[model samples]
Target: PPGFVSLVGAGPGDAGLLTRRGAERLRTADVVLYDALVDPAVLALAPSAHRFHVGKRAGRPSVSQRAIERLLVRAARAGKRVVRLKCGDPFVFGRGGEEALALAAAGVPFEVVPGVSSAVAAPALAGIPVTHRGTSAAFAVVAGHAEASYGPVLDGLAPGTLSLVVLMGVGERAGIAARLRARGWAAETPAALVLGASGELVHTWRGRLADLPGLALPPDRTHLPGTLVVGAVAALSLRSPHSTEAQPAARADARPT
Candidate 1:
């Protein structure tokens, strides 16, 4: 009998944010191929499962997508209950669709368990709502890695018209800011970079669009996974009461309009 495969979202590096269904899948998995960003606590739940680190981090030698798909198929064909776990929502730039397509072509049965995407969740956890009654009615989530591809998209949208959320953008912060400015986005538009959102080490840097390129560089210069939030919504922050980090104190550098 062919075994089943489950593509599960790990959710922005926070084990607590993981959905019950995702956890159940992990616990029962005969083998789990998980990403680097998955919280260790979550992985602990599947102690008995054979685990493989198939994560691809920026600026690092990592597993190729093709290899990962092959591993998934091979394991499932061996009648193992395989779980391909990823950070954030599987379909949101997580390459989950690609894997699913590969499995289908290989005649493998699979299921997808959705997890909260960092695009909206990160901003919300940092107290910035992607949509507000009067401030914003629509929001755009874009990948930050390819500025050229998204240039036309950004050019068409009027500045301050809606909220913009960028995932995996910390590496291209400068280029992203320059592109937005060239596209007529206001220099004073509020922008924020949230690191480790929904996790214990959460940190936020708030400023204006023009300042984003500089603010993106944290003191440590560690290439931490982050989400970039832009627009009026970025100016609003309501830190969760449960957050260990205190409320964002006024920053002399923040050019909030």
Candidate 2:
């Protein structure tokens, strides 16, 4: 009989956010297959487990998803408890479901342990409330990577009513804003780019939707992670001690004519 597999959420870069349940799974894991974003410190927690790095860096070559699947199945056949760690919540576009499906088809036993996903975690760590009374009533999370069509899901936003949070949206900023504007989202909506959230190098730059695409940014690409929060709640972040606090009012900064 094959040993079990556990798909674990490693949270955003900070190990402080690892779920207690995830840690327990790691302790029992015979081998740990972890993501690119998991902190090395957290990886140390499972010192006795055989560690395999299956990280996917932006713009860099990475292991094929099929190979990752084979690795998990091979380990399970060896009767090793395998933990497939991923950054952020496994259910939120982390593609954990696909892996689970693969494992199920192969007859592997597995468990899922949730962790704080960076979608909400990075925004909160930046003092930006994703939802607030009288500010944003609903929120949408999107991916920044190119699509089969126009690129990132920012096109789904209706424009003014809800807060929008985007992960992996660091690229193609200008085009994203253009599409959102064409879709009717106000160019005046306040937005921010917060990089390296929850760690010592955390940084944030606030801008109106029109200006966000052109804002100066940090040099780190794939290694430095970020979360973008937009809408009225974007304004409220100024009240927090850690917020950069110099954002222009959303309505005042409409897209240039």
State each model's CA lDDT, in order.
0.85, 0.78
TM-score of each: 0.91, 0.88
Q: Compared with the true structure, what per-residue lDDT tens digits does model 2 show for residues 1-257?
A: 56999999998867778889888888888999888878887898798899998888867888888899999999998999999999888887788999999999999988888878888878877668788878878888887656433443556556777888878777756767777887887878898888877665677778898898777686664357877777878766523333233321121222333
Tens-digit lDDT track of model 1 for 98-203:
9999999999999999998999888877778899989889999988888776667777778888999989878788988998898889899999988877655568
Cα RMSDs, all models: 4.9, 6.7
User: For this target, which candidate reaches the highest TM-score against the unseen true structure?
Assistant: 1
Error of 2 at 174 (Å): 1.4
Clashes of each: 1, 0
lDDT of 1: 0.85
Clashing pairs in 2: none
